[model samples]
Target: MPRPEDSVWAVSVAQVASRPGQSKPIDTVFPAPAGIGDSVVGVREGADIRVVGSFDSIVDGLVFTGRFEAPVTAECTRCLKPIDPDWTVPVTAFFPYDSGACRDDRRTGHGKDDVEIVAGEDESEDVYPLSPDGAFADMESLLRDTLVEALPLQPLCREDCLGLCPQCGADLNEDPDHHHDVTDIRFAALEQLKAQLEAEQTGR
Candidate 1:
């Protein structure tokens, strides 16, 4: 059986978990978990992810408040240019001391229903489970969830990208004057009829 502490994402919090009002600071790097996003816009798996934050102990759980920084790779939505940038996201999550008790309470309808309802109403913070012995808090799921939610759906290299020309697929940013002289469709039939009359007069 693998130990919880053996995991790379696990952080030992036994010192702070012993009592309320204690705090533990964390400043370290962990590998990015898989499935943060897709090829279009995402952080690569195994990329370095920096976490800077602290865990504060409360009566029921530990509250982690910090920032996550990772390398994000994406393409510009308008121009289709490749872009790689560092993305920073603020995160706050709860590592409950007794997750099983909370689950049992919900199942049996026997404890703290009002408290649970009030907690559920505030969707800003996320909740995760600590190790069975409450000695370690694994952050794999939290990191994945945070980064995934923070990914931009429509990423851009620049705000005012001109994109590609519709007629010839030319880069509008590179060639601002590039264009085609297109005759109006409404005048096409009349132009053809006038040409035919001229041709017939010449033949006659």
Candidate 2:
């Protein structure tokens, strides 16, 4: 039985470049930021993170792909109230092979999406820690960054979700009389006319 705080995983960070098909879990919550070039942004995630990823070498950095799961007790986007959503996110990222890119991409005003930050002197380091142990294995930052990437730009429960009824404040799904089906009165009158015509022809 490993205590939450005492849990630390051993990874083969340096060998990712040479040996393929390697992966590990960086389990912990920390702080960090997101972005690389001109557009960079802040990053954050749950207190604890569970990262399951496979890392291989790339020209720029270690290419990693996997899923991260954590207890996300955040407010519902609709209600703006607390709603626990066990958010499990799948991710794909490139851990800068060299920290040089992280340092080079430290300029501001490159546009929000134009730049990214791996590790810089600015911002909370806890939010975006290292990735690999010897190579900057900040599982915390990785989880947060991947989460930001995975988040839906326009999140919704459904495409056509009729949210809580504005009138009686009821969930449309729960309320039977929420959206009533209406028949046209003109059509009903025409049916009666047709019936009368048929009755006259039958002389009944």
Candidate 3:
């Protein structure tokens, strides 16, 4: 296949057709998203991706896959700052079923669950791209999406996350010594009633 001018960038294949286990190829690193919040940009490294085959039949499907230890530079959960977070996903996926057979298979997580894989389509792209002409998807988009989907509805820098305090909008984790108390709206009425009762008793 055609490659870029950089010799450092190359695609390699393993002995897979012979063993019917995995077909090897060079991996690529995609770009990350802009701004804060959870992002999926793995450290760039030259690794191999293999396409595994199913034993039952030779259906037009994506082959064997694997996951690598992906190192993500993210912010610390506590400080709202960047931190190197190690994240991983099943990098290898199969467009196993052709046009008809490719059903939404969420339980297994190998095939399309909500997204649709076109039939009679070229599987040449990356696994995560809208187009996978190279059998490699854009890791940034795919992994980023996974990271966002997996993140808590409410994110924290850390478990003991010092969230923004309501009163002063300060990080509780940063300055634990600071304290504040809220006024009691409901109890204010009760206090007034108590004063009236005290006056009635004193008067009687």
Candidate 4:
């Protein structure tokens, strides 16, 4: 069987988990986990992801407050230009000591009713499980969740992108004054009739 600490995302927290109020600083780079986002806007798998923060042990769990820096690839929603930017996301997640307690609480119907009653009033923090021995905290799911949620719904190359021309498909940012002389549809019949009469007169 594979050991929990063997995982790439696992961080050794045995010392901190020994007592409450303990602190452990985490500053390292891990490979970006899969499923962060779609191809249109996402961090590519195996990309470098830097995490800088600390884990503070509470009475029953460890709270991780950190910032994630990742390289995100996307296309501008309006201009359709390729954009690659370094995205930074702030994250706070809980790694409970007794991981099975939450499941047991729900199974026994103890906390389920209370949760449903005050679901609107409560804002639940992201919760992850520590290793069975409580020695390691795997960060794969946390990293994936944070990055996915922070991805921009509509990415833009720039704030003032002019986008493409609707009629000619020309890049408006390159030629701001580009346009077509469009005759109004309301006066189309009159203009065509006038042109036909002028042609007949010229022919006569």
Best by TM-score: 1
The sequence of per-residue lDDT tens digits that candidate 2 reaches over residues 63-106 is 56677775543433343334344577777655554455545554
* Candidate order, lDDT descending: 1, 4, 2, 3
Candidate 1: the clashing residue pairs are: none
Model 2 residue 101 CA deviation in Å: 8.5
Task: Please provide, for model 1 over 1-204, each residue's C-alpha lDDT reduced to its tens digit, 9 standing for 90 to 100.
Answer: 999999999999999994889999999999999999999999999999999999998766788999999999999887788999998999988887886665566667665743364266234558888899999999999999999999999999988988888888888888888899999999999999999999999999
lDDT score at residue 152, model 4, on the 0-100 scale: 95
Q: Over the stretch 1-204, how does candidate 4's per-residue lDDT look in tens digits?
A: 989999999999999995878999999999999998998999999999999999998756688989999999999988888999998899888887774654565457666643342232224648788899999999999999999988999999999999999997899999999999998999999999999999999999
Which TM-score value belongs to model 3?
A: 0.43
Model 4 root mean square deviation, Cα atoms: 4.1
Per-prediction TM-score, please? 0.87, 0.45, 0.43, 0.85
Number of backbone clashes in candidate 2: 25
Candidate 4, residue 65: lDDT:
89
Model 2: CA > 4 A from native: 1-47, 58-60, 74-83, 99-134, 153-160, 179-204
Model 4: worst 10 consecutive residues (lDDT sum): 114-123
Q: How many residue pairs clash per model?
A: 0, 25, 30, 0
lDDT (C-alpha, whole model) for all candidates? 0.87, 0.48, 0.42, 0.86
lDDT of 2 at 172: 65
lDDT by residue for model 3 over 19-129, one digit each (tens)?
Answer: 323445434443334322334323333223222222111223444344433455554544456556555555434334333334333334454523243322335443322
